[model samples]
Target: MKVLALLLASLAAVSAQTEPWCRCAAFVTYEHSEIMVFEAPEVTIDSCTDDAKQCKNSCTKELNDFSNNGNLWLVQENGLTVGQNICTYMADHFFYFIHNHRVYGYFEVCGGAWEYTGVASQQLLCCNGGKHEHCISK
Candidate 1:
C-alpha cells in the first residue's frame, strides 16, 4: 500500500505540471452577415493576447469593408484537458470593435464581464515567452 500511494502522488504532480493554462475559441463576424470560427489549443493569456492581435490585423486586411461590431468568444478551462471531447468546457463570450483597420475596444471574461475601449498597435517580433523579441517581419 505504501508503494501504491507514492506512485499515485507522483502521477498527480506530473499531471498538474503538464496541464495547460487555458483554452480559447475565436469568432469573426463581417457586416453582421457572415461568421467565422477558430478553435485553438490550450495556451497562456499572453499567447492569447498576441493571437487576438494578429487575428484582428489579418481580418482587417482581408476584409476591407469590415464592420467594427464583431464578437469573440473565449473559454477558460482551468485545470482541464482538451482532446477529442469538446463539450467539457464552458465558453465566455466577448465583443470587439474594429476601427480604421485597427483593433479597438474589448470585453473581458472576469468578474461578470467588463468593457474597455482602447487602441492597440502591433509590432512584428519573435516573442518566445520572454526569451527573445526580434523583428520577424523585417
Candidate 2:
C-alpha cells in the first residue's frame, strides 16, 4: 500500500510539472518583410506579471526606436482586460507577428529562453502566400 501511494504521488507531481494551461503561436510574412502577426491563447496578466511589464516596456522602447515605421499590434481572445494588456505589452516589446484567428507559435513567457512549446501549422500558411509548398514536407 505504501509503495502504491508513493507511485501515485510521483505521478501527480510529474503531471503538475507538465506544460502550462495556455497556448501560443507566431508567424512572419514573406521573407520576413512584413510584420504579419502572432497570437496567444487567453493568458492571464498574473501569469506574466514581472515579465509582462518588462516586455511591454521593452516593446515601447523598440517602438520608439522605429518611430514612424514601427508597426505592431496585440489582440486578445477569451481573456480578461489584464490579459489583453499583457498582449499589448508583448507586442510593444517584441516585434511579433499577430493576427485574428491565427497564431504561429506558443511559449511560456516565464519559461527560460521563451521556449517554444508548440506551433500552429495553419498559421504557417500565411508565411509563403498560403502555399505550403516550401514548408518541410512533414
Candidate 3:
C-alpha cells in the first residue's frame, strides 16, 4: 500500500508538470472579408515567452539575410522581444502579451496575403483580461 501510494503521487506530480497552462486560439482578420484562425497547443506563460524569444532571434537572422541579399524593405527596427512584453511571430500571424501580467493571450491583425515576414503592415489587437472581456482558458 505504501509503495502504491508513492507511485500514485509521483505520477500525479509528473502529469501536473506536463499539463498545459492554457488552451489558446488566435484569429487573423483581413479587410477583404477573410479570416484565419489558428489553435495553439496548451502552453504556459513561460513557454510562450521562450517561443517569443526564439521567434525574435530567428526573425532577426532572416532580416539580416534579406539585407545581405540587397533587400532593403525589411529592417530590424527594434528587438522583437523587449521590456515587459514579448511578441512571437508564428508564420501568418503574431501574438504579443505582457510578461507577468494577467493576460490570457495576445493577438495581432495580419493583413494582405499570408507572409512569413517578421512584421506585417497590419493593425494590433490585445487581450489582457480586462473588465468585460474574456481570454483564453484551459
Candidate 4:
C-alpha cells in the first residue's frame, strides 16, 4: 500500500506542470515607446507600493535605448478593470506582478522587474532591473 501511494503521488507531481507566470492584482499596460497619433504618455508616476513601477520603467528604458524610435507594448488584463496573467515569454525583458491583498485592484505590474525576491530560482525575474526607492514610498 505504501509503495502504491508513493508511486501515485510521484506520478501526480510529474504530471502537473508548474507554469509560474506573474499574476497581477490589477490591470496593467506597458508601452515601450510613443505611439503615432496616441498622445497619451506612458505612466511617469512612481506610485507602486512595491518594485513594480520601477520595473516597468527599467524595461521601457532598456528597450527604447536599443530601438530605432519604434514602439512596443504588452497588455495583460482580464477585462477593463481586472488583473491579468503575464509571462516572461511575452516580451524580451523579464517581468513580474505584485498583489496587495490589503486592497482590491490595488497594484499590479504588467511586464517589469521591480524587486528581486532573493530567490534565484524564481520564474518572473527582472532582466536588468532592481529595487527603487519610490516603489516602496507608499
Query: How far off is residue 88 in model 2, in Å?
Result: 16
Return the TM-score for candidate 4, rounded to 2 decimals. Answer: 0.19
| Candidate 2 residue lDDT tens string, 1-138 | 999999999999977774333323343434444332444343433444355544433433333332221222222243322223334444565633333333233244444444333333332221222211222333
Point out the worst 10-residue segment of candidate 4 by lDDT: 117-126
RMSD values, in order shown: 18.1, 14.6, 16.1, 17.7
Give Cα-based local distance difference scores for all models. 0.30, 0.37, 0.33, 0.29
Per-residue lDDT of candidate 4, residues 17-132 (tens digit):
34322322221223463111111123334433354655444434433332212211222243211112122321223333332211111222434433321111111212112211
Pairs in steric clash, model 4: 51-114
Off by over 4 Å in 4: 27-138
Q: Could you give candidate 3's per-residue lDDT for residues 1-138 as a string of tens digits?
A: 999999999998867764223333333444464233233333343343234444334433433342332222223355222111113332224433322222112221121122232432122333332211122443
Decreasing lDDT order of the candidates: 2, 3, 1, 4
Error of 2 at 36 (Å): 7.0
Candidate 4 Cα RMSD after full superposition onto the native fold (Å): 17.7
Q: What TM-score does structure 2 among the candidates reach?
A: 0.24
Worst 10 residues of 1 by lDDT: 81-90
> Candidate 3, which ten residues in sequence have the lowest lDDT sum?
103-112
* Counted clashes in each candidate structure: 0, 12, 0, 1
Model 3 quality (TM-score)? 0.20
Better of 1 and 3 by TM-score: 1
